[model samples]
Target: MDLELRHLRMICAIAEAGSVSKAASALGLAQPALTTQLQRIERAVGGALFLRDSRGTRATPLGDLVLARARLVLPAVDGLQDEVTALVGADRIGQYRIGATNGPVAAGLVQRLSATRPASPVTVHATWSADEICARVLAERLDYALVGACDPSLPAGADGLVWQPVCVDPVWVLVGERHPLAGRAEAALAEFAGEQWASAPGDGCFTACFATACARAGFTPRPPLEMDVGGCIDLVAAGNAVVLCQGTVRAMPGVVPVALTGSPLRWRHLLGWRPGGPAAAAAGELHGLAVQAYLDVVAQRPRYADWLGTNPGFGAQPVTAAAVSRR
Candidate 1:
């Protein structure tokens, strides 16, 4: 008569794991709480549920009956959680304010309406850094953010936010068209060991990758000029120096994309937001768009902003396979 879902779950977990401590870890609950559940269940059922030995807890005859029923009920409960997740993903709220890193995400943004609702107040702001965007969203000043990684280390004290996968950005070593190493399908650290690089500030993954690569090659690549990411391609094209470029900047013109054969390196873009907010509805649509945009680019959609010249309407043309194929 005292049987309940919580009691059933604890008993099943204990029976399966064979130990209360192990069950507690699996359920993210405390061992004391799990033990309390077991004791309460035994009293309610009028029989001890487990045969405790030196090894661990095991199901008694009565416990076996309880576990069998639990095996069936637990799966249904798990199914319910899955359905709730789908329900959340499919939800569309009317209006919400938003912010994102200021950049063209291929043509992905084209998949949108003017606002979430009919005349519902919605604002979308664009900024320079992912941290800035995430901060605004966490502050409740903005509802959601579309941002690329900044600090390779995810910000600490980010309990107020939730994250979703966006895309993987490959960091390409960029060299001038006339550079001696530009002719190769891939670039090597030895080719530019003593050369200067245009590096941006931050411990971003791309920057970390480049530094590590250079360190392995017995050299440290000093920046010819430390500036914003936009300026690196210009420096590379002018032959001032080579800049280890991220996937985000590879598609921009005036730079050649050279793969690194020696090690693994990639940058990730992520969409993040607070748990509950007005923007929840639009955040879902934008999250899907961001993912699609990333996929389109990863499939070598070309036409990356880095390959675009410093002219108005430059990004209008996508980078053709033939263009990057020459790499």
Candidate 2:
């Protein structure tokens, strides 16, 4: 029998489970049938891939080699399937579907797009995971993804997507009005060394970036309490912990977002879509609207607007001439 993708998957499953019986259960196959299939796979490969001991199954050198190749091949094949599915089920000509992580831009962008194209049906899906949003875009469930990432890192699942920058905002600290640092125009990271930190849950590099910043400031950060946005705000307002937030975050009742002195951490908002897909035809218009939406949000936060004026490079990035022409 020729080695097929399913055979490779089964091999990987057995290697991962460390026992034929366990792998069979996980794969929803009877042990005897799985053993018969395994024998056929072994004959096709001309080697004993795994060794069975009384304890469990372990991969031989040949099995390790096969596993490594299977790992690479599987994801590539999966990506190809997603891409083909997207092409086959492209969005309707006048419809717009956007996926977004927690941020200010998505809502505003949707509003602007609906206004611009009154006949077009615009929709937005919210999530806490940029990777999930991007995968949806790749799978054609979303025409675009508006998400934020730590300044220098791109979202995962960006392989075949085109990402355009909307803006770069400084990361700020949220503290209660009663907190001593609340009155300060800007505070240093070292000042928060002993304070407990809380933040909205997200699948991004911000957590690692925050940790590195704290280490550079000569202290280790406590593992931050991860919760929804409202929970994070509650923690900050109660003075139980401080939260990291974007500069454009609006004022809460008792919480204020203060800039970090040296701007140790920064976030970049991005709008991504599958290249050459239906969204590509309107990418320029969508990107322009996204940038304007971000600017509008910044305007609502006077403190952040003034900070942007003083700190020139942290606002809307100039769209390059080449980028404009491409769009």
Indicate the worst ten consecutive residues by lDDT in candidate 1.
318-327
Candidate 1: segments with Cα more than 4 A from true spot: 1-93, 102-107, 110-123, 150-159, 201-209, 248-253, 298-327
Q: What is the lDDT of residue 289 in candidate 2?
A: 92
Per-candidate RMSD, Å: 17.2, 11.4
Off by over 4 Å in 2: 1-91, 321-327
TM-score of candidate 2 relative to the true fold: 0.74
State the lDDT of candidate 1 residue by residue for 1-327, as single tens digits. 257665676787788798998987776544654565466578789999899899888889998988898999978976885676557543435545567654435245434433224455446786544544565566555666665553233422134576654554445678888878887766656667777777553312334445666687778877445567767667888888777655455355666767655424555455667765556545556666665565555456454443323223322223222211000
Which one is best on TM-score? Answer: 2
Model 2 lDDT tens row, 1-327: 467766787899999999998997776555654676687689889998999998799999999999999999989988897787657574477899899988878889989999999999988888776766776787677889888988866764465777788899898899998999999999998999989998765645566678789999999999777678899899899999999888988878999878899899989988888777579889889999998998899888887888888897888875655431111
**What TM-score against the true fold does each predicted structure earn?**
0.54, 0.74
lDDT of 2: 0.82
